[model samples]
Target: MNRLHPLSAVTYAIQYGFLWLWVPIVLVLALGGIFDPISPAWSPIAAPLGFLAGAAYGIAYYYRFEYGITPDTFDVASGVFARRSREIPYGRIQNVDVRQGVLQRLLGLAIVSIETAGGGNTEASLNFVSESEANRLQDQIRRRTAYVKEQRRTKQRSANEGEQQGSQRPTEPDADSSDADRTGAVSGAETDTPSDPTAVPPDRADRTDPDSTPVDGEEPDAERRAYASEPDRQRRQRLFDLQARELLLYSFTSFRPAAVAAVLFVFFLATDPIIDLLVATAQPVGGPQEIGEGTATNYGILTVVSMINGIVITYLLSVAYTFATYYDFELGRTGEDFVYERGLLQRYSGSIPVEKVQSVTVTANPLQRLIGYAGLWVETAGYGPESSGGSQSAVPLAEQSRVHRFTENLTDVETPTFRSPPTMARRRYLVRYSLVAAVIVAAVFGLAQVTALEGWYFAAVVFVAVPPAAHLKYVHIGYFVGENHLVVRSGFWQRRTTVIPYYRIQTVSTRRSIFQRRLGLASLVIDTASSRTFFWGTPTIYDVDLEDAREAHTAGRKRLQSALRERARDDDLGLTVDFT
Candidate 1:
C-alpha cells in the first residue's frame, strides 16, 4: 500500500497542535489564577507539552495510514490505536474530488475526497498527498470505474445470450435422428463447455470475454487490453470560464438576505454611540430651545448617514465574499461528466456525472435582469460540500442568451413559451397585498396614538405600491410543458426558471392553500430527486385554475412514464448510463 507524502505529517501536526493550543489558554483562564497558585507558574510549560503530544500523534498516524488502488477496488487502512480497513469498489465510486488550501498549496500537497452515491458525504479522504499523486489517483479511479462498468455490461450480455440459448435448446433427444447426427451434436456441446473450467477454448482464445473466469496463469496484458478499450479516457472540452468583469458584476448583483440582516444588526448596535457622538460634537448657536431643535435635526441626519454607511459596508462584504468563493471558476465536460474547478483561497475540483443531473435552473434577479445577465445552476441527485442544497452553480453570471443556449444544449430541449395563470390569480395577489398593507397601516396608527410619531400616514405608501407589486409577481410566474421537459418560473425579486427533464421528475402533485382554493385555484408542484426541493419547496406553478392544475398533474405523470420508457430503451441499446 502507498503512504501519503512525508510533508503530510507537518500538516497533520499543525491541525492537531492548534486544537491543543486552545487547551492551555482555556486552562489558564479557568483554573490558573482562581483555583490553584502552582498552576499559573507551571501553565507556561503546558503549551510545549501539548505541542509535543500533537506531533507524536501526527507521526503515529502518518506511520499507520496507507491507501492503494487495486484492480477493482480502492483500499484504505488507517488507525492509531485500533486497526480499520475499507475497500470501495471502483464501480460504486461516484466522484473523486481534489482540493488545495493555502497551506497545502504551499506544501505542494492536496487533499483528495472520494464520494459515493446515496451518502451526502465523502466516503474516503486522503488528507495530504503530493499534487501530482492526487491527479494520478483521480485519473486512475476514473479509468478503473469505466473498466468495471464495461466488464459488468459484457457479463450481463453474455448471461442473457446463455439464457436464450438454453431456452431454445430441445429438452428431449430426437428419436428419429441418425447416430452420426446425434454424435456430432454431442461433440459440439462438449466443445462449447471446456473440460477444465478455467481453460480458454482454442476457437475463442483471441477474443476477450470479460465474464470468463481467469486462468491460473493468465497474462497481465489481458487487463491492460480491457483498460485500453474504455472510451471515457479522452480529452475534456472547456464549457465555461468565468471572466473577471462578469464575476465583479455578479458580486454586485447577488442579493444575499443574510448580508442585509447582518448589516441591520450591526447598525442597531452602533446607532446609540453614533447618536451620542454627534450630539456632543454639535455647537449651540442660540438659546436653549433653538439648541434643542438643532440637536434634534443633527440626530435625524446622523441616523440617515449611519444607515447609508451600513448599506455600503454590507455591499462591500458581499462583494468580498463572492470574490473569495468564485474566483477563477472554470467548467469543462469530459464524456458523460461535467468537471468544475473553482475558489480563490481553497481551490476545489470535482466532476458531476451527467446521469445524476436532475434538473437545470436559470435565475436572474431584478438587477441582473436589467443588465441582461443571468446565472445557471444544475441540480444533481446527491450533495457535495461546495454545492448549495444539491444545486451546483454551473455559470455564476453570463449573458442571458448564452445561459439559455447552454441550458438548451445540456438538456437537449428547446425553451418553450410559458402559460400564465388565470386573471383571478392576479386579483388574489392584489387582495392579499392590500390586506397586508391595511394591517401595517392600522398598526402604525395605533402606535401613533401612544407616541409623538408624526406622519403615521406615510405607512399608507404600502397600499399605493401594492397593485404594481402584485402585477409584477403575477407576470413573473408561469409554467411551460414541452415535449421532454417541464419548466416552472416564479418570484418577482429573483426570477427563477427551472427546467426539469420528464424522466427525472420523481413526483407530480397539486396543492391548494386556503386563499388559492377560495379563488378556485390550485398549485401544480413537480418534484425531482434533488434534495434542494425538499428544503426550498418543489418547482411549482402557483394559482392555476383547479381544472388546469389537475390536467397538468396528469400530463406530467404521463410524460414522466413515457420519458422513463424511452430512457430504458436507450439504456438497453447502450446509449446512456443506467444510474439505477
Candidate 2:
C-alpha cells in the first residue's frame, strides 16, 4: 500500500478552503437581514476560520485515503465516515492517463487517472504521486494484465490438447472382465489376439466429445489459429504527430466563426446598459459632441470599434484554447497499445489499448477538406455519443493520404469503398430543408404580425439558401458495407467517415418514419457497443431506398452474427477447468 505525496495535503487544503469560502457568501445572501449587524464584521474572519477547518479536513483525508497494487488488482481504500474499499482487476483497465500541470510538474508530482471499460468516470485516481512512480505503476499493471491473459490462453490450449488426446485414445476393455466378455463378439480366437489394451469400444466408438466441436464449418487447425506476436516495447514507433503550425491551421478550420461572432454580438447587446451608465458618469476632457437624430456616422464608428474589439477577443481566446488543448500533440504505438501526449498548461499522457477501440472516424471540416487534411478519432466501447465525450482523437490533423495509411496499419484493413445513396435522396433532402425554412418563415410572419414589423417578411429569403444546402448534404451522405466493417460518411461541412467493425455491432435496425414511408425510403441504423452516435450524432443513413435499407440491415446483421460466432469460438477455448 502507498500514500499520496505529502504535498497532496496542501493541494487538498487549498481546494477545500476555496470551496468553503463560498459558504459565507451563500449564508449572507440567504439569511438576508437576519444577521446584518454582525455579518459585515464576521465576513472578514470567515475565510481564515474556513481555512483552519479545511486544513483539518485535508489532514483527515490524507489519513483515510490509501491505495495498493497487487499482482492482479488495484485496490483503493477511502471514505471518512464510512470506509469504502474498491478493487479493480488489471484486465478491466482500459486506459491509464497521467496528467501533470505546471504546479505538479514543478513539484515532481503527477495525477494518475485510471479509466476502465465501465464508463466515463475514472475508476481510480491517484493524485499527487511521483511522476516516475505513476509511470512505473501503469507499466506494472499493463504487464500483469498481459500475463494474466496469456496464462488463461495457455490453460485453454492445454485443456483443448488434453481433450484431443483423450478423444484419440482407444478405450480398453475391463481387465477383470469374464472370459465371455473378453472374447470378441465376432470371434473368440480373434479377441484372444494378445489381449490388446487399446481396443475401441464396440458401442461407444461412434460418439464424439461435444467440447471438441468444429467452428465456422471447419475443424480447428494450425492454419486457422489466430496468432498475435507481441511487439518489442523498446522500439515504440511514432505513428503520427501534429506540429504547432499544423495545429494552429487546424484550429483556424473550426466551423464556429459565425457562432462566435453571434455570441460576441449578443454579449455586447447585453452590456449596453452598463456601457451607457459608464458613459454618462465619466467626465471627458473634451465635451460631448452635438449629435443629431438618425446620424449614421456616429453609430457606424461605435459599431466598427465594437466589432474590432470582439474579433480581437474571440481570436485571442480561440488561439489560447487551441494551444492549451493540443499543443505538442504526438501519437506513438507499442505492440497493441497507442500512446498519446498533448496539452500545454496541463500536459496529458495516456495509453489506449488497441483491442478496446470500437471504431475509427476520419473527419474534415470544409477548410480542411479543401486543404486535403483530416482529423482522426478512435471510439471505444461504453463511450457514449458526442455528448458524453468518450471518443478520443487519434490524431488532430493529418493529410488524407497519411490518415488512410495510418488507419490501414491500425485496423489491418484497407480503406473501404463507399457507395452513395439513391439519387432520389436529393429530393428528400430538399424537402426536409424546405420544410424547415417554411417553419421559420411562418414564425417570422407571426412575430411581424405581433410587433407590426412587416419588414420581417423578408426573412422568407432564407428559403433560397436551402436548396444548395440540401444538395450538398445529399452529395456527401453515403455508406459502405465492407467485408467485416460498416462505414458511414456524411455531413457537407464537417465530412466524417465512421468505420465500425462487425464485431462491435450490437444491433441493426431499419426504420421508416411517415415522411420516409411516403417517399418509399428508410434509414439504416447500426448500433454498436459504444453509444457515441446514438443521439445528435449521425448514426444512421437516411433517405435510402427501402430495399437498400433492408439489404444493408441483412448484410450487417449477418456479419455481426458471424463475428459473434467467432467470439463464441474463442470463448470456448478459454473454458478450461482450473486447478489452483
Estimate the lDDT of model 1: 0.75
- What TM-score does each of the candidates earn? 0.77, 0.75
**Candidate 2 residues 416-488, lDDT tens each?**
7777877777888888899999999999888767853557778889989998998899888899888867888
Q: Can you give the lDDT of residue 546 in candidate 1? A: 97
| Runs in model 1 lying further than 4 Å from the true structure | 21-41, 150-234, 256-299, 442-452, 533-536, 572-580
- In candidate 1, what are the lDDT values of residues 241-275, reduced to their tens digit? 99999989998889555677776686689977755
Model 1 poorest ten-residue lDDT run: 571-580
> How many residue pairs in model 2 have overlapping backbones?
2
User: After superposing candidate 2, which stretches have Cα over 4 Å from the reference?
Assistant: 20-47, 153-235, 255-316, 383-387, 443-458, 533-538, 567-580
In angstroms, the error of model 1 at 578 is 18
lDDT of 1 at 434: 95
TM-score for predicted model 2 compared with the true structure? 0.75
